[model samples]
Target: MDAQQWRIDVDREVCAGTGLCVGTAAGRLRLDAGRARPVREVVEPDQAVVDAAETCPMEAITVRSLTTGEVLAPEL
Candidate 1:
């Protein structure tokens, strides 16, 4: 297994499940029954993940740098 490089959180209640994040970061995000969730609780810090968070219509996805505790997407 690999160490988690980033922390990705999806607010299911806030997620509209429009698939914007999933579409942008298919490998990181998935939609189940119109509820959006991370493929896993943690993932390698990737640009696609950031893009997914940025493109979320509801701003429900949050990506943070595990090392720096910095919010990478949605620009806060």
Candidate 2:
């Protein structure tokens, strides 16, 4: 069976140049042009990535389960 994958997204328009996501998951995310972006669109499931998404002050980061299409971060 294939391992699960997660999809990370950051709304550039909503991002406020906060580095929280990058700080939370440095290896999985980075700051580009003062905005946070995922190192890769799709990645292996990672808690740090989820945490980063959850902690985004602008609520700009989003993490989803690729296999299930379930939103994984920024709990509503």
Candidate 3:
């Protein structure tokens, strides 16, 4: 069987902690003291996660595939 791979990152320095990620991808992200924290280093996020990452004003959140190390999106 193939291993499932995933990755989620947040730049605390850049994160505004708007709660957007937590609201959008509750299963993958949560608010921790006003900061967005990934439930795990590797996550299988849905469209919501993608949207949150894309819409983050600070461009702090990053989503990627763990196995491939492909950055799904980077902060702009």
Candidate 4:
């Protein structure tokens, strides 16, 4: 069976290296060079992805549904 691949975006310029996303979504998000980035091109992120995006201090994370193209985070 194939899992639905989710899509997430992170703006390095907007990121503050707060580590909130990394903490909330451990395997899915990572802190590199003091910036937040997705570990992979989605692969099937959980609700923690959304929580991480929502919890971002800089609001630099954006989560979207790859199949439906629905924006799931930042409320826009």
Candidate 5:
């Protein structure tokens, strides 16, 4: 994985299964079993993923910078 790759996580407990993330980034996220999950945990930097995180109604999605461990989405 590249140092600048993005890491995606979804808090199942906090997720409302609204599928907003999936709609925002279908290739990067999915709604499954009443929760959202990343299609892949680590992926190349993608704006769609960030949008997905930001669009999540429950704020269940989190995107991070793999190398710096910085929270990249949901704006804190």
Candidate 6:
């Protein structure tokens, strides 16, 4: 089976330091300098991460497909 690759990116410029992503996706997202940052450039974000992205009020978190360039969601 192909390893489904995923990536989580946080737009620090737009981030409001809400800490929602960190709270939602503690495994993949963290609060840095009051902004959200991805723990890794590429991560197989579990459901929590996806849920976190959805919960971002600023919509700063983005989840995308690494190989296909398909945006999973603007905020998830």
The number of the candidate with the highest lDDT is 5
Q: State model 3's lDDT.
A: 0.77
In terms of lDDT, model 2 sits at 0.87
Off by over 4 Å in 6: 1-3
**TM-score ranking of the models:** 5, 2, 6, 4, 1, 3
Per-residue alpha-carbon lDDT of candidate 4 for residues 9-72, written as tens digits (9 for 90 to 100)? 9999999898888889989989899998889966575889989888888899988888887887
lDDT of each: 0.84, 0.87, 0.77, 0.85, 0.90, 0.80
- At residue 18, candidate 3 shows an lDDT of 90
Candidate 2, residues 1-76: lDDT per residue as tens digits?
A: 2448889989999999879888899889898998888889899888998888888888999898887879989798
By summed lDDT, which 10 consecutive residues of candidate 3 come out lowest? 1-10
Give the per-residue lDDT of model 6 (tens digit) for 1-76. 2358888888899999988888778768888888889888687747877787788898888888888768886632
> Where's the lowest-lDDT run of ten residues in candidate 4?
1-10
Which candidate would rank higher by TM-score, 1 or 6?
Answer: 6
State the lDDT of candidate 1 residue by residue for 1-76, as single tens digits: 4445898999899998798888788778888988999988678868998888888888998888777778878787
Candidate 4 residues lying further than 4 Å off, grouped into runs, are 1-3
Best by TM-score: 5
lDDT head-to-head 2 vs 5, winner: 5
TM values, all candidates = 0.86, 0.91, 0.81, 0.87, 0.94, 0.87
Candidate 3: Cα lDDT at 10: 89
Give one digit per residue, the lDDT tens place, for model 3 in 1-76: 1245667888887788898878777788887888888888676546777787888888888888777777777544
Which regions in candidate 2 have their CA more than 4 angstroms from the true location? Answer: 1-3
Q: Candidate 3 regions off by >4 Å?
A: 1-4, 74-76
- Per-residue lDDT tens digits of candidate 5, residues 1-76? 5788989999999999988888889789988898989999999989999998888888998999998889999897
